[model samples]
Target: MEITAKVPETSLKIKQKAIVIGGSIAGLLIARVLTDYFDQVTIVERDRFPDEPQPRSGVPQSHQLHVLLTQGYRTLNQLFPGLEEELASWDVYTLNWTADLKWLLPGGWSPHFPSELKTQSCSRNLLEFLIRKRLAAYSNLEFKETTIVTGLLLNPNRTAVEGVKLRHSNGTETQLTAQFIVDASGRNSQTPQWLKSLGYEPPQETIVNAFLGYSTRWYEYAGNEPLDYKALYLMPRAPHQSRGGVLYRVEGNRWIIGLIGVGKDYPPTDEVGFLEFARSLRNSEVYEAIKNAQPISPIYGYRRTENRLRHYEGLSRFPNNFVVVGDAVCVFNPVYGQGMTVAGLAALLLDQCFKQHTKSNSNPDLKNLGKQFQKKLALANKVPWLMATGEDLRWFTTEGEQPSVMTRFLQWYIEQVIFLASDQAEVYQAFMEVIHMTKPSTVFFRPSILLSVMRRMLSRHHKS
Candidate 1:
């Protein structure tokens, strides 16, 4: 396998090095940019990597459908020039943005569907293979598979990060040194433990988990036709039960669909049982598709997902030469398909911070690095968080945070907006744009949009 490597065109040499303690998307991305900043960049992973584009058992969400949001795509293109070209080289599908998608939201169908937002579809394994292959080309970067870091090595002051003490599959222990260390280990990250061992303050965290369960499966495409499909979302009303289903177009000429619900609402893994789950979504298209599409794998289920946030930025005493991004920072509901995109954005943020630091040869002060990155990357997650959890929380009543009247108004308005979008193409596109994060969620507040909403409200009132 010929992995393509890119070298920055510069004479400035890297006198220092960095170590990334995870080989997932976040870690890979960090290693990718570090090649330009460090003399040596090493990525440590506990799982052994496959030689091809196959899912590793280590990544829980490997086989599922991973989406590339518009903003994330743009950031990736900026960071890795010719990214789309690379994916396309391997036959990855860059389907029509919003114009071509048949996006359905709980409110109804999206408005201005095509004009509003567009998405990229592909299996996670394939994309990961291609990137790893390309990134391996970096002369300064190296990967250590089947190696796990037992803990961190701290200096005498223990105020700064230095390196990691790791144990490999062979049961041999080694100390890997680096000037900078990043804990991209994600939701299960042990950085907290390492910090405590060093007598440093632990990062503050906020967990908002309500125990939502879900199941997913993928099917191979059997034909070439327009996907004028409905995304059946069995959602909760202002004060109703929360249950939903989502179907997405993916690479390999296939479709990936998931059925999700809170409490007693999750879909079953049995073939016929899963079909019934689709049927319960109050849509014919999803069930129809399941009956027609060829199954590529057995039904897969995931319930370990919980909304977790480690606010390293909020800590008054963070390691000077360290930073954390991706799931290690803030992870949202995967049903929103924002994880990968958020990781891409976090990678972009890392690039900006490093580029400035290396360019000016500064001390790499990180007092606000974690906070700034968290705040910046979080801007992408706010809408999706509210869209997914806010709805789910409504299921058990007295379960979620009390929503304000404005929240209820927005929820009602969004439903109408969705219903209109499905019927009116212009509305559909605009709704999609906001949901896909292509446009700000506040776009609905624009003067023209408000007029349209009032018209929709009046029409609904008249019909009632």
Candidate 2:
């Protein structure tokens, strides 16, 4: 591990070393920010990372596809500029959400609107590989692979983390001392239970489940195969079956198809059934596109689609010097693809904390960092949660989150706005801006947006 100094803004010695558990994207980003305050940062992982761009044992969710949103890509590019170039070198596709690609929001199929917003995508393996390579060059950022974190080592007061106990691959045990510890271990993180053993209660949990499933296959686009895949979407109507699909170009000239469902409906993993599922969508373009293409892999399926959120920050006794990111804090419906974006927002919040502490006269609030970080982290979910969870509620016949009266009104209004926007440029752009995450949902409530909605409602074209 090689640690290099990029800048020296203050001579104030960093009294704290930091430890980050989890080698996933969330963990890596936390390590990136901790460099500003820690003399050294170590990442612990249970899976032995690959030497080349490949998959790991622990990150099974990576078997599916992942794309970095505008917010995530922007945050990462700012921290490690030139990353996109590096990813492109590995065949990652940089997609303009509106220009280079086609998208189907619940509102309607996305029109060819001029777009400044862009998202870069590739296989999860390639994305993580590039990030790992960048961080590996730093001597201060250490990687202890195939090691399991047994539990945290709390001080006598049991209020702050002093270090962590680890079990190596050979079954050897060791204590890793650190001034700050971040639990980026993801959805399966054990920090909550570990905290409970030390006399802390686990945080409250919120779940909005929509039993969704997807079957994916890697197809090499032969001649005439669409590289600029029109992003396809099919949202099921309420009191009826709700299903949707997404087909987009990923790295290595491969395309990924993610078909989602409400309740028990799902895309089949069998070869023939996969095709049937694609054809079952509202549009047949995706199904037709893959008809004669070569399939290099078997049809893959994953069904772990439940929205789980641990309100760790809401806990009355959140331990000092700890913060959780990624799936550990909140796991969203994969079909929505907000997990990576939300994780990026969490890392940016970490960056903000680092900047504030670096500029502060006193040491930043390490003990209260969890709480402060939670506040910022929660903001990341506010819009996405509303979007995905609220949408899920619409599919609820037997189970799902129950929407309030305001939610009911908003849903009806959103449907009209989206359908109307399908033809009205101003209405379409406003809805697009919010859906792509370029702007906040509050943008929908603006007086200008309201006028656009009203005018569209009054227009005859919209009625048609």
- For 1-464, candidate 2 gives per-residue lDDT tens digits of 23233633352346568899999988987787776667788999999999876767788777676756777777778767778777777666667666665655555666676677776777777778778888887656789999999999888888888889999999999999888888889888897789889889888788888787777777776657324453555556554656666766777777776666668787888888888877787777777877777887777788887888888767788777788888898988877677776777787788777666656544555667767888788777777877777767767542555778888788767766767665666666777667667788777777876877777667857678
Question: Per-residue lDDT for 321 in model 1?
Answer: 69
Q: Estimate each model's TM-score.
A: 0.88, 0.92
Best by TM-score: 2
- Tell me, by lDDT, which candidate is best: 2
> What CA RMSD would candidate 2 show?
2.9
What is the Cα root-mean-square deviation between model 1 and the actual structure? 3.2
> Can you write out model 1's per-residue Cα lDDT over 56-135, one digit (the tens) per residue?
87798887657677776676666666667777766556556655555555556544333434445667887677677777
lDDT of each: 0.70, 0.75
lDDT of 2: 0.75
Off by over 4 Å in 2: 1-13, 225-230, 235-241, 362-365, 455-464
